[model samples]
Target: MAVEVGTTEPTEDVIDVKEVTRAERLRSMVARHRAKARKAAEQQRVNVARRVNEWFTSTDVTDAELAAEIERKRRREQHQGERELRDRVRMLREQLRAADENTAPALSAQLTAAQAQLQIRQDEDADRMKVSGRDLVRARWMKRATRIGAVGAGSLAYVNGVAAEPLLALLSLGAAPVAWLYLGREFATDEAPVVPAAVGPDGTPIANAAVPGTPFVPDTLAAMGRVSVVKPESGRVQGEKDLVTALIKAGIITAAQRDETHLAGVIRPSGPGWTATVDLPRGVKSSAAVSRVEDLASALRIKKSRIEISADTTDDGHEGRFVLWVANEDNPYGSEKHPSRLIDADRWDFWQQGIPLGGDARSTRHEMHLLWSSLLIGGLMGYGKSYMARLVAAAAALDPTVRIIVITGKTGPDWAPLRHIAHQWIAGATPDIIRRVLGVMEQTIGEMQDRGTELDRLYEEDPESVPEGKITPELAAKGMGPVLLVVDELQELLDGAALVQVAIEDEPEGGGRAKARSGRDLMVEGFARYVRVTRFVGGMGVFITQRPDADSVPTKLREVCAKRASYRVKGDRSAKMVLGDDAVANGAAPHLLGEASKGVVVLDQGDEQGHVTLKADVIDLPQFREICLRGRQLRIDAGTLTGDALEYGKEDAAAAAAALLLTDCLAGLNAAGIDRARTERLMELLAFHHPGRYGEMTRAQLQAQLRDAGAGTTKKIGAVDGMANANGYTREQIAAAVKTGK
Candidate 1:
């Protein structure tokens, strides 16, 4: 922004422009920054559109009915072309080597013939723009464009007739580099780059645009689906480096070629195992590409298979993802994909948002909800939902602020973990429990509404107040903490007509003047509105369940489930029902559930623009087990556990693991970013109560246990630590403890 200023001295008669006030300047700066960001985002979208258009116009990629088939053809052609050149090179080298071995005329002839072939290959390579050649062209173009633009401008100035000899002399000043580049000789080999035939929007090749040997690039695994740094080697299995060495000895890959040719990256331990990446030479066939990805999977002891890619999974079928966690005994079923693997043809339960298997780092905690936003775990029998729920349950156990409540309809699998972390674990995701839970949530909702109202009042009262989101738990404690409601396999809640009926009976019509709104139809509608508009509460309404459809889910629940997580559906239309049309677009074949995608899910919701392939993250079962098993005794005062105290501390760790082995298991959990403090507190209680094999209690054991439990060591201290870390302790716990202690 600019402003005009008048000169006080009229003699100096010069009007000056001045910048506005500091606040205005700051706002202007912010606006400029935002504009720049918006422009960049727009440019990226334009790029994607352009790429999509290019593909759609290509011949080989235009067969929408058989896009993968077209991709396979192109890949085969490309691979053969590159391979022929490579084989010719190898033959030439071999002929030369044989000639060196013996003075044989046949070897000499072969060597000469090989050299001729080499010459031809080199010529083709130069024109074909091998990666190295592309690098040169890219570099030269940048330089040439810069120089020509600069020198051409100056030369035109001279051509158009410059003023004088003195001016002409200055004109050439600082233009030497431009002149050199402009006058430099350009070079081009005989070979020309063959632009690929355009691929259609459906990833099929366009007849006119199809390139002979282009590799099929299906950025998403459509049809089928599907943590940690727990190295998979069980002592007998080779360590990463040693295994790589062994592979080299076995002629799987040469040691010299490991980093550049075959596996381009170093071997590293990933969640539950080890893996490496291979960057195949350009123009490799689709089959070869599959072979490369498969070879790595084989080396890593992972299942090799093909997954169908869904078009609704973002425009390119490679967006909105996070993980690709492998399913095993511990996490038998998952809600969505995790960001671990880049690809998977295996059974998958869940996938993460913005994450792919074998592509990048593990998913972060804050992203868990967003990535699994489309996931909901629930089943009728034997506990399938628990497979993925453990991840959520375990997370809450570690973080106190994450107050998790697990309500399962059936007991086996879903009811396994969370006995420790979940403040209340219901073996049944039952109607009665739902009723009780609804009653509590109703209270919390009323409290939150009142708080929202109070915040408005405060703003009116002062005209300067903290924003709603800025309302901290501390402030909320003074008012009401944000309430979170998580129901597993919501089908049970749907079944509980009696409990639901009672709540309806108590519900007052015409907006009763009660402290909190009842769990009535209107209330459910209000909840829907809240979930849709308010992040603070929608964030709170991150409800989980096995059934993820309108029918399986109640009308009340469905209205507010703006975000849903899906594992696998039974059929194509079912997948559409679960993932929605825009998100799970896997062509005629629905990709999320069905026979093809057992574990993978197409995560979609009302607000989600589209779905994408996401591999689910692997859970740390050992750590989860430790938390649940020991969380029984790790007690803390909810009232006293204020501010930072709500955070887990060292005292918590020693107490929990005092009875367990001293392997860096705790470290693994922490490095994996599992709940560290709560794990400790829970472990502390387990050690005190179920002292493991250290069962033969001695005076020494008691002292050691007490010390680990944060009791002041020295013989003088008694059962204060033990008492503090007690079972069934609540708000009135201290009073009872004090009564007993005294």
Candidate 2:
């Protein structure tokens, strides 16, 4: 201990160390192994149960099953081919018997070839049957041998201790026998070859296979069974499922009501999309689905605009039926419009063939019958309201027998191209222009009356020529062409504020002022009368308005219009106003059209189907101008050019304005039933008739004008009714003055 400070001394103390036997260690290892084995066995049991369930329930085909199915299909196709060959041979023999000498040789040759082909098919079918039988026998033998071999291998493995565990040995010994018990029945008895039955196009079983000369008849009950068969899901079937699911989700139909409704037929291609017919439940109407179009689109994950639902009003049973069309593109109407058919037309036969306006959703061309009908077009601004109207005007212009009178409240270039061919082109929304519009309506009313008189005269002189009491093409060609009045921006002329005030100097009772009447009121009355009387006399009116409210188009006028076209509008109210409440209820959805759907309109031609939604033909300014030029040339060739066309840029504005005064004076005299009137009274009537031009005219000026027109000087005249004496002219004087002026 006294050696060095860094050195340590060792001291021994007794310590006990625990030691285990080899047997205990082996027991611990064995316990861990047993736990893992138990866990693996439980997992194996679960996997086996899952596999068994899947094999029983899964629709997936195994390799052997798939091969067998393919072979069966091949046999069926071969049998069908043989049957067809036999039918062809029999048909050729019949045709040969009926053939003439010139065609007999060809028929005989075809018959011989068909018979040979049929014989060859029969021989091939026999060979295939033999081969199929041999293959089946071989397959059965192979399965039996595999079962025997598996049993031998399992027994040997168990006896040689290759399977260590008792459970493993038992599984090995039992697997082959289990497979035998499960599969042996398939090979125990030989089954007859399955003969493919004759099936219809819809996969329904038909009657027994036809003899060579007999017809193949379908079984009605079996045919009905086709709808009940479990078929592999197809695109159409999936689409139908999706539609039904959407309907259910949309609350349009309940799950319990699913079987009560059904698709009328298989979904089929239509235009650029797919179409299907839905047969609704008894209490459901097609409008129910139409009203829920947006809900359906949302559930189906499609654009709302591309889904079109219309009532199938083709028959009495159509109340519960609807036609659904789903377009592939978001915008089925397309961004660009189709060119108008009238643009290239040399001359439209408006009498025999109607105007080709545009194509429907199915791309089917639709024609508008302008004869014996009036058209009312309405919509929001910039939605092709004017374009649609001008299209009609252009179509009428192409017909040389149609006299076009275009009056527009808009002074834009939308109607400029039509001016070249118009009989009376009046444009502007000023008070003067509105008065002129009223004046035009009055003149048209007079023309309608004159035409009616002429038709009556024709009916009396040559009743056969006017058999239907309507204008004929022959009569139209003989200087009695139809008159078409196209009024654009009609609301401007129909506004309540457009009034004309006139002063009465010589009242029958005393000098009193006459109440002012709006030009709108007069125009509406005149138009109503024209529409009511001119339909049979070859007079058509096309009234277009951007404002489709009640005030824009009066009820009386709208009721008389037989044809209606509505472009995109703001709401259902406007749509109903234009197309009628019944039309909208029946499934006309013009309000659904978006800004991209320019030139698209819903036309209600008073047909049983409610309305036709179509894209109007596009006639741009250049094309329209060219068409009008062509129309002008046509009118010139037919010797039918008159009115503004005859005096375009040649008539003096002041002279034309002055000339209307004499006509107004004479109209006033006729209206009052007076032979003559005082200068003050005549001026008042003139002011009322042409408010813009003559509202401020003086009595001296009117007398001077009458004096210049070869009428005698005014003098004191007794009141024709109960009025005081006044210096008025006679009706004869005014009539003579008008005649002299003309």
Candidate 3:
């Protein structure tokens, strides 16, 4: 390497190897350490400055945000309180308006004090708002001061060479004002003005005053004179608005009538539902609402069958008032059947307590007074017409003094249980059955006349006993009992198919020959007469028919029936026919009842309220039979069991048929307007009227049967039809044979 001419052998610059003293080495080390400490100190100063700036900036932002949040919360709370106060005022006003005179003064005082308190609270809120604004301004200024102080102290510490310690102390001191602005200032601010408690006229604080019947006890002076803050029971408050809206939408009321139409009282609990009284406009009758129940239900979001609308008859001047009952359940009558009250009772007093028919929609028990009123029940088939008829029969059967007569056009078992207690039980739609029905009618009429005669005698003998000229319970107890005549499926006897030949008394040109007439007319006339005459003398008629049309139940008969019940019918026309035009117009809408509403019926007993809808008690076959057996035992014990009940299954069927044939012959002779008829003509008449029974009867056979029936010996008689004299029988002989059979 030394051999190169210009390289100078890659010379190394030699450093001086100085061996330093201890003091010199220590100085070097101290200088290095001091430099390192200075760098760290600078970093600490930067960090402190950054933290102080951050604290100031964040504190300013947080103070502003906190003020805004506090204001928002205060406003929200204030608004809620105001709204609640307003609602309380409204509720108290409503209660005051509805309060009675006795409670009105107290309610007025409470209202006055509530108004005053509400005003005070509003004023207090306004004052608090103003005070809050001042405090907010004050807090903001203090925060700015604290921020300035923190910055000034840090700047001073940095300038004076005491950065870390003084800045830390300044931050600590600044926290005091920050904490005061955030927390202590709230306590230092002026408090809200307190409201004075309301005192009654007796100088007692209303907050301390005990309210009778109410559980209102105020805890605060501000709560004095205010209504109970508890919410209204159930949905009454909200339901009122919904009801009004629904009514308006249903066209039950006009928008202009909204003010006048309101709930009369609080919606209270009823059976399976809630009941409320709606006060409609003066010109709007309750029937308007009742007729539009479907529309109301639709608007109210409920089932039509679950809405029960009835006129409020409790007040005389309130035709616009009605009761609205809304059920929560789908079927308001419930799923289970309501058994008859008589099921548990051994006997019933028809004259005293009447019959416990069933309960109503409100679970209120209802009774049917069968003493002086005749009931006319009509509905579609299988819609409780026969069941109701049997209910009446069962009620009557429970009373041994009540003589029951069961006659059903249907030969079903519906009326069979009644046979055990019935004085005269007849079932069928045959010609013979019609003849027997007429005979029973005639006998009932004769008995009614006899009863009238006996009552007249009683009046003559003891005027006090027969003051009302009506049968008394005492008279009924002494063997002169009430009679209950139930005719189920009455349309069968009052239909066009039920025909008979009746003598035309006015048709003198026809030589007293009979003219064919609808047997319904005869039956209607007889029934009308029976109901008209017998209702006054301890006789109650219960006529039930599925077809409640004009032809089935004539107006002549329907008008006389004082009590009427209509089950589910085809339309309003049928309901009107059963319940009367007035009843239907007033608020009776049996047609609105659904087909599934079997035992439900609209009952109109000529009440002021027009009609009431209720579910009839169900008395099944077994219960009916049990009741009948008990009735039979009671009758036996009282020695009152008679007629069909006495010889229910003991009589010979063949002999009874023969006796009934003889009776039919008498009825046929009467219809022909002839006192005497030849045996052949009588047989022909019987065969023509009742062809199924006597279609193949020969003259010899008729004579032999008549002789066997002790209907007197056959003799030659003049034939009315320009024929030769033939062996014949007289009406007197037939009537004699009937009496002999009895």
Candidate 4:
């Protein structure tokens, strides 16, 4: 190369050789880098393989974790077992412990403390059971002496010739030794008699009998006078406890029965005697409590009638609440000086507080507010049934806004005073009177319709006028009457209706009879369905009946009349007839009422599910007349009374009488299909229906009368047997004429 370089000088081939060397160096460097990367990858693969192998074959590690878990479970179970064993050992140690000297000092101390606590508890129990030693001793000795005296009396009676005395003497002599053996026995028992409060005849509270010469003092007192006012609080407390204990001891209440009736608290003096409120146990009703009243009174050594019990449901509507009034005397309504006054002085403002029913045993006044009420008054004859009905009627009469209607089926003067205030009065049970009653009912229907329309209009105009959804005093003051319909002796009406029905079915009478019967049935159904619910609509119905049996008064009417008053019924059967099916079982024994219970009645306690004793107010005829006269004057001043009642004219009387007669005749003759009648025939038919007005009319007079009354109309009549006939008037035409007062 040195020889050629010398020859060729500088050749371009050197540059190419240098470039080739650089390229070769670059390739070698790349190969070295790839080899280093391969070594790194191989080391990583080896590390991964070692880790995986270690994971699969590490049995010692798995065994270590499993051993740790097993140790934890063992410790948990062992702890549980130790706890249970400890409890068992503790119980055993307690069982082995004793309260003797050998016992531990702590246990002995505990035993001593327990004994002392027991003694303290016993002492406290004795204190709670403590009673008046003086009263208890006196009563106990008196009872013992009474027993001894009875025995001695019986021995003397046996010496005489009294019947059954020898047997009583022998029995007493036989029991002497046994009784003497128990002579020193403690006379004080848990049960003691309740000493009742003293009350005078005028219902004034009397002082206690602890002093001499008091009226309530025991018969052993030779000289008794008025005692100082002894506070009855302590005595009442003892009485409450003793009452329950005596009841239990006398077997009126068993140990299990204790839960059935509970004495609420201490007795409280109310009215004549002490009143104790009691809570009837589960499944026991006020009626059940009432049934046990006699036994309860006997257990307390009081008269049966003295125990006045009133059973009612609690205010919360859950259990039974019984009020037991243990009176010193038998009379509860003996305060003649305190006649029941109206609950409120303002009759119009307090219409809902309607009329006073009477005063209760507790002197709480009750009312028979008939604003939205239908009442049924029933009882045996002469047992104040008529009196109660009259009382309510009189109450209605006292209100000028009330329009009174009396359907007195019986011909009596009991309701005679009602006529002065009555807008319509039917006083007998004759056929004509029955027809008049039917007319009255029809008129009542018309009145109801008119009132309903007026009421709607009034309400639409101003709802304030109809307060409480009823006819308020303001609405009634505007010449809108609150109608009251009194049906005394309702059975007669029912019987008359039934007879009419039978006659229609049997065809014994005629088509008129059929029409009359149909009308009656319609009116009765309408009355029961519509009129019964009209109380809130300003119409009230009072149905009085001697017999409230199903036949006399329909079940619909009975149910409609929600307020029932029964007095002196024959038995449970009759009582249930007036009240309800459960009346007898609910302790409504009206038959047991004595003759002295003239004004007393068993009144239904609506919605509370029982009956209560109510003494009705007795208003004489003179008082009723005064009330009627006052009401009449008020109505006149208010311009509510008008027509014949206010200013009767001869024409007005004749028109009214003719209208009544026309109604009676139309009811019978309309069914005959003879609407058009000759004047003579019409007069004859009217005479047949009501003989009092049309019976003496001649053909000319009747024609003139019909013409004057605007009942005569000209209508062509068909020729009969080739004879000319004049036009005749129809019953409808006559009725329309009567309404117009032509």
lDDT of each: 0.40, 0.71, 0.73, 0.60
Clash count per candidate: 109, 9, 0, 7
RMSD of each: 34.6, 25.6, 27.7, 41.7
* Full-model lDDT, candidate 2: 0.71
lDDT per residue as tens, model 1, 93-152: 455556654656665666556545543543343234222323434444554565557767
Off by over 4 Å in 4: 1-255, 259-261, 280-286, 291-304, 335-353, 467-469, 502-527, 581-589, 605-611, 642-742
* Model 1: how far residue 114 lies from native, Å: 53
Give one digit per residue, the lDDT tens place, for model 4 in 434-471. 66677667767776777778778888888887756677
* Best candidate according to lDDT: 3
Q: Write down the TM-score for model 3.
A: 0.56
Candidate 4: 10-residue stretch with minimal lDDT: 219-228
lDDT of 2 by residue, 1-742 (tens): 5766586565875543333466677889999999987986666566556544534443122222323444566668875886687567657766876999999998878776776675466446434532233454454455556666776897787677754666776676779666544532221122122233445459875432111111221222223222211121211223345566667877778888877777664444455566667888899888888888778777767666777888887664478898887776777777766666565455677777777677676556677787888999999888888778777888788889899988887788988877777889998877777777777777887887898899899999999989999889999999888999888888876763255532223444764665566666777777888888888888899999999999997888888898999999988899989989878877788888877888889999986656888888888888788788888889989998888877772444445555666677788877877677777777777777779878987878877766766676887788744578777787776677667657
- TM-scores vs. true structure, each candidate: 0.37, 0.57, 0.56, 0.51
Candidate 1 lDDT score relative to the true structure? 0.40
- At residue 88, candidate 1 shows an lDDT of 62
